[model samples]
Target: MDASSATAGRTGRATDAASRRRPLIDLADRRALLACRPDDAEVTEAGRRLKEAALLDFGIKESVVAAWLYAKCHYQIPTTAVETAAVVAGGDGTCLLLYNPGFFTEIGLGGVRFVLFHEARHLIHRHLYAEPELRADPVFTLAAEVAINHVATQRLGQGLPTREVPDGRGGVTTERVGIDPREIHRSYRADLREQGLEPLGYDDFVLTDLTIYGELRRMRNPPVPPPQLCVHLAPDGEGPALDDETVGRVVEDALTETMRAALRSGGLARDEMLGLADRSESGGERLGRMWGRLGLAALRGETQKTRRVEWWKRWLSDTLASKLREGERLVYPKKQGAVLLALGHEPMLSRRGPERTKVVVVALDTSGSMPDRVVDWLTTLVGRTDGVESHWLSFDGAVMPFVPGERVAGGGGTNFGHVVDYVEGRLEVDGKRFEETADAVIMVTDGYAPAVTPQRPDRWIWLITDGGDDWPERHDPPMACHRVTTGDS
Candidate 1:
């Protein structure tokens, strides 16, 4: 019997692991078949060689390993009677069978390889297990599908036979027997949706990979100072032709927007021109009009275009100067010591007995790698308040009590989970849930820690990092973040 038929009756996990040990066909039979020109006896051999070459060229030789493992690990049944399909499995563990010989022929060997790789990629990403987030993860799904398809196209073209199959034979004889790329793309999206992944639109085909590569690069060598502003410039604009002058304006504009919204308002107004200082923020169109007036005013100052109408340069310099001044102040009111007095005056807290006052556990990640500014702000936030008792735990790899008002322990390896476990224990002992037990748990670190999950937090704030570590698939807590600058220390 042929190798495909030899294991036809097998099914389930019992044989799954064992099947991974050998080639798709017995060795002797494979060699004899590959040693010949395309013929009836060599059709399966041709298919095997095409699959092998496809796997090697595509950088997914493990796909074959995966296929063997999957086959050995699950049930397999003969589908020779079916005419136009290969394999289909939904994330829910339900699977479909097809007897389409065109699966091998019509799409060509490369296409089959890509199909397998595409499905395996989904499994590796654990998309099948996370239905709710499948749509959200279309980036991974679509990029993976493209990669698989590229591989399949390359391999099947070079390896699979182009000869016609005899009419009575069990092969697809039609010229256009392969799955349509459009249909395949649609099916790919549908599968992603069924598994809870948001299907990425065609636009995301380019966008998703761009974001992924960017993120991966960042993860390897984390960004230095936290990002002060995130600006997504439209790519279509011929805006100033991207010279140094244009780049400067873009950066300046981005900073101006960030500072105007995030930083406290106090700066030199454009010109001595008295304009209405409305309490309500104006639209960008109004702002643009104002900007134009300011530029015309500057131009009116000096007729020379170089001096009077350097709109971008003047706008950048002034905006940057203002933001630089505001950057000296922490963006959050609570972190600046202003919230303590307000909290003390709140009616509910004031009316409650002193005995019911909440406890605040502020754990600081005093790792060797943590920046000094983090320790200072951490100490300040935890120490600034009264009306409620606060405990400080300073940890590197394990927890220990630290002096309430001092910056004593820090500069060691950080373990974020230790803080979580410590807080969870404290909440348990206090007979209170996280929300009630403490007003907040403020963690200060660079976010260089193993995966950690805390008990439900009424308020948990991350003060150390702009970014890092998104993993373990789930169990992520909703986090409030404050980007800290390294210069603040």
Candidate 2:
């Protein structure tokens, strides 16, 4: 069916007297209301259709990123809790998309797609640019809406949500359901011109989210008010307040999972993921930092500019955390475990025991090529981590045990095989036999020596220095390798 006819059918069934009688609850009571399910069948059906159209129609066909994100959420609740729609953090460390059923019905399928896409983009925006000061600015809020809607219109081919309304002559006329960005832009242009200030052309005005925000900040009297339809944009007490950390964790998990799926699929989805990474690189520093955490820039064969060394450090810390925590399982409380045992089920327990200390071998190439700063940072990180026993080695054709921050003299050729052999208990260093099986082996080098696979290749993590070769990644059985870009180059 065509757009209008399909919308009319949904509208006809959704606008019955009973459905229209559904009371609108205050945003402050959103949590309580969302805790309960919709009683009206029409409302429930409307919610289902809205979700289906968002996932199947718009998500799969238009934006695979959306599809993966919505699928990751797993909960699209239809209720009278929210005035419009919102993506809020759940207690279980996930996110939920809550939408008002009546509002969905009023907007129809096309509007559903637009609203869903807008909400998804909001999560990403929050994830990328998460400065409290930026979010607090009303101008920034409006700019975000404009940027999101611009992408929506360009991608979904719908500028604004429209619905048929009856005229006095008994004929239907189309009326817009949401804010029009072009109208807002016109107002901004006119206001700036009246104030004798220079206004950017439309093309330059909506270039990026930050660009729009920067332009809007120059307005003496901003033409448009803050967006009222976005529940997320509502002030502190005006709507459901979400915990920033929870939202960040949820969005990060979703985006990471989406990138993994996209890479595995390797088609349009992967292209879209790469495009997103590329855009993030130019979008802003915070955004670029976020994509760096996901390690998507490396997948795109791009090196992240090291504006701050903190990003790569964080990435290495996180990677090390996972590597060190391998073979650990989540532990349930004693009481819970007993209850589950009584019910004929196995009890889940914590992954790491209280007394278990992980062993790690860190090999640094000291052939006069590795940076001193990288070694200093690694020393600090390893020293700060609890329950870890680290073995530091400085290598140059031969391996020597060295303490962090100590002066080591080495000028010989590089040999990665020597480091691997030492870690695997083959080559003894300083006439001592290394017996402990390390949980993780980290090699920081310029990747100059020949690649040698360790006894347990999976346990090895390679950090390639700037202007270095990444041969380990192209080996027969590829090892995990990451490029450390210090922005010094």
Top model by TM-score, which number? 2
lDDT measured at residue 232 in model 1 versus the true structure, 0 to 100: 8
lDDT of 2 by residue, 1-489 (tens): 002111223445433232233345543344665665555666668667776877797455677767766776656676655555677664456667777666667677888888888877777777777888888877887888788888788778877777665554867677665556788788889889989988989988877777788888887876554435466556665555456776677667767756654543446566667755643466667776667656675556555563332335544555665665445512234586558546754333323555556787888888857667777767656644555677998889888888887888786899988887878788777788789998888888888887798888877888877778878778879877766754453
Please, what is the TM-score per model? 0.28, 0.58
Candidate that scores best on lDDT: 2
CA lDDT of each prediction against the hidden true structure: 0.37, 0.67
- Candidate 1 local accuracy as lDDT? 0.37
| lDDT at residue 192 of model 1 (Cα atoms) | 60
lDDT of 1 by residue, 1-489 (tens): 001111111111111112343223211122322342222323344444554554454333323323422342132222232222223342333232222222344345554455444433333223212233432343333333333333334433432223233344544243322222344445556656656666555434323333322222223222221111000011222100122332223323322332221211112221111121121013235444443434433323334432223332232223222221222311223233235434542111121233434465666666634555545544453354334456777778767666754656555577777677667664232343333355556665666677666665435655444343323222355454433344421
Q: After best superposition, candidate 1 residue 97: deviation in angstroms?
A: 47
lDDT value, residue 455 of candidate 2: 82
